[model samples]
Target: MLHIKNITYRVAGRTLLEETSLHIPVGHKIGLIGRNGTGKSTLLKLITGEIHPEGGSIRLQNGAKLGVLPQEAPSGPESLLETVLDADIERKNLLNEAETAEDPQRIAEIYTRLADINSHTAESRAAKILTGLGFDFEAQQRPCSSYSGGWRTRVALAATLFAEPDLLLLDEPSNYLDLEATLWLENFLRNYPRTLVMVSHDRNLLNNVIETIVHLDQLKLVKYNGNYDFFEKTRAEKLALDAAMAKKQDTQRKHLQSFVDRFRAKASKARQAQSRVKMLEKMKPIASAMEEYSVNFSFPSPAPLSSPIVTMENCEVGYEATKPILKRLNLRLDMEDRIALLGPNGNGKSTFAKLLAGKLRAETGQFAKSGKLKIGFFGQHTLDDLHPEDTAYQHLVERMGNGREAVVRSKLGQFGFSKDKSDVAVKKLSGGEKARLIFCLLSIDAPHLLILDEPTNHLDVDAREALIQGLNEFEGAVILISHDPHLVALVADSLWLVSGGTVTTYDGDIDDYKKQVIDQARNGGSGNSPSAVSEEKQPNSGKARGNSKEARKARAEARALLAPKKKAVQKLEKQIQSLQQEIEKLEIKLADPTTYEKGADYQASVSTEIGRLKAEQEQTEENWLIALEELEELENS
Candidate 1:
């Protein structure tokens, strides 16, 4: 167990946490959630003793081992697997000591200690963790310097998980993961035997893995008894109640002041007025809930587009002609298409999105677009491509040609930049602010289609929500490549699976895709690998011919059998959505100040209704999973 007792932390005179106390029992999975800059990461550092608090103390049970995901990847020529294995510092130290120990008993003691720490299996365990996090066998053997920064970050995460500490602290572990690895990680953490504290913005991950939520609000930590969804509802209720109480107290204070003013001059009422004044002074003032600042904007309506916005026939896309990442792909994007490209990282999802956006040329076959097509493409490197010296106003003005300053400022303001902020250098802006600027630029003359590649990389919850709202209202066709399941589920109407050098429409939703990835990972497939696309065309063999027809027939029969399961899954999806809507409605009613004024009975009834709806939502989700599993079994059979 970890105990935080009245902890206070400050930086540069700003109090991030003050008198905050929390108790996390062993084996409890808790999510540290708050707005982006509210010290979620700092709190993790404090727990690990990287930084000391201004007051109070954090205590862990004696002999407790804690592991933290390092912000900086260890730099060396060591192989990836070796670097991860090095996380077992005690075991490494024992081995080093044994090499120089002169006495046989000392050597024996060291070997015994190594065995106690399971040091013999450390390499294999590290390899497994590396593989699960998207490294292949060859990649894991490569030196740490050979990997890019992102891959190194993943290696760090793998090493942290490999350490198997009693208390693990993970800060946004899912941020670097694709959907497949994220799913695998969720399963891994669900079965984790020790206490875990993670800070994440991934809703699906939090919902599926965490059992408790520790929310940082106004320099205080508040614990919620359930997952992210539960925390949201619980927090909403608390805020609503707080707001109501504040309003009521304000009303009473005003009434008392009015009476005091009227009766203070009357000798008969002097004593009564004095008593009222004293009572008012003694009454504690209720603090209103802190309102979070959020960006508010929408994409401009897209220019008119042809029915088929874009089309590809037998397209091959890659940077090099000799080696294409994807090939023989047939795809079409209609005006109403809202497609999310699903695949592991570096498996041609971004390549496909680029092909659709005209950023990459097809190596072979026809790639056609409607004459009216104009695409707004945002890629992972889009922010990096911005002119750092230019202000937001300058960027907009340059893009808008001769547009008026007022118009440019108005556009920037809509995207969360105020008059003063619009003049700040782009280089000084945070990544999320830069992303917002990109969106603003994209909306100037809205294109017929938008291609977004990892748009939510640096965005906070509010910014992500704003982006979702904008996408929901976008009139143009959208081809999104994102690892965020929440955004994909809410904005994408269809899914395009880009794998095995083939881009095909997936018959199911995001949930179905998640299950497929998880299954693929469990079946010894590196989800990050290019979907086994054969580069060379092989001549048809007699043995292959004998099995081809029967294999085709079997697959057809399986697909046919999958129809009802798919329908069932879709039905459950609708039921879940309906229940969620009903729950949101109930929550909205509870949030209303008038609802609380109706008395305790009314409030209790509203709470009960919300609870019932949440229960139904959970059960509906379970049924959805069953339907999905049935569909998978049929498809795999």
Candidate 2:
């Protein structure tokens, strides 16, 4: 539904996109991906007309609606639900006019449009979108100013989704969400019935939610009719074939040049030498894929120590002595542990990580670690802790404790920083570059334990893969808290549950944890405790309770009883659609004067047909409503 043709955009004397063209068809869910600073977000802005491209055009289908998150977070006195509902401008305007519309014909038109759009369900739909984004019912009723900036941004996202425009644009939507909400959004996008164009770096999201991959490579746009994994495989094959062809052409050119060089001296071979020269001049070289610069995260292996380097028995940790965020944390960390903490945000996962990193003391109970233990901790706030005016070189020199300048520069270079980048101030660096600097700082000493909290928030997919490799190769105990499920699955060999003001050992893998998170979100925040995980594993639990023959028979009987009601609803819906088409055609004929010119009889017959079709339509609609109500009651029962 959207078309971009030969668009060229430049920023700050750097060309990000050069004569790139892309066409997104109706109902296609596209994922726009590229390396960091490759102008993915800039392309979205070009489509939205926020900024005009230097060359070519962008166009959308006529009358098609567009939805995008606002640049700024919503604020002021509006309630969250009201903000979301107001996104559907048509519904809001029609409903407001229905209250004061005095003309009978106008009232009928307004009500008919309302029914067609199912305006009655608007509130529930808004609430569902808000809840999927992690807003509870009470939170939905609160004023927008009551929330933090991040939460306010989520409300803007909720409003955009509730609008359900013909074409939707999302940019790194999952960055603001936790794993639980991310899963919910993934499921929601999988079922979205309209066109979508999203820019994301999360691999799992691209693989699960997108149907097409539109890659920005080599300053141009390339389209692939598959998901990210499929695109990767196809691009690899293409690159190999191109390389092979280029090599063959080079060999042929060399052979032709040798022939010309050797035969041009002889009069008899002049004709053959000229022919070879012509062939060599006509042959053109093929362009192979260029290798991209990759980031390296080679963490130093820590010195070996005995098992169980750290232990916590009935520990309680928090900022306040009286109000502990996490309590009774009976846990242990051996020298070779690779544990991933699982829970929603605001559930004390970070508190528990801080406790392990020696940043917080146990308010109660016993907590002990080896006397010689060293910890390299990376918290979410670590990036903010850097001095903006300090260069990467200065920061390293300060942290490394009077190390040699060459040694410090070499360390920075190992993490993908060049001499110029190392000299740049931290304030001017991009998010990914800042993250690389943090990794470089954290891995200098290679402590006995590593505690990383959401370390992949700014890293791209390739850099994250590098991190996954680095973490697996590191020989220190690790405690990771991250939203990226792929990294967690590949790196963590064990799972730890942090919820309900305590920490415990989870008995399932990452997949099981994902299913649990989705289930809890869909079920209105129920069954999210540690016990829920155990209950899910038990036989005859949840919806499978009472798996006896009697139970099976009763379930079958209920299904049989409700089958006709569903069929009736479906049949009437089809009939209504057919009848509406017929009515429109007949009304078009009645509007023409030619029918009256034929005779009064012909005109009367046409009018009679129109009346009969209207009667049938009204009756069928009533029947459909009844059937739908009955079906809803049966399903709820």
RMSD of each: 14.1, 29.2
lDDT of each: 0.83, 0.85
Question: Would you list the clashing residue pairs of candidate 2?
Answer: none
* Strongest candidate by lDDT: 2
TM-score, one value per model: 0.78, 0.79
Deviating ranges (above 4 Å) for candidate 2: 253-285, 402-406, 526-532, 535-537, 540-637
Candidate 1: tens digits of C-alpha lDDT, residues 501-608:
778766556665665567677777755632321223223333443353344345335434654576588689989989989998989999999998899999999999
lDDT, candidate 1, equals 0.83
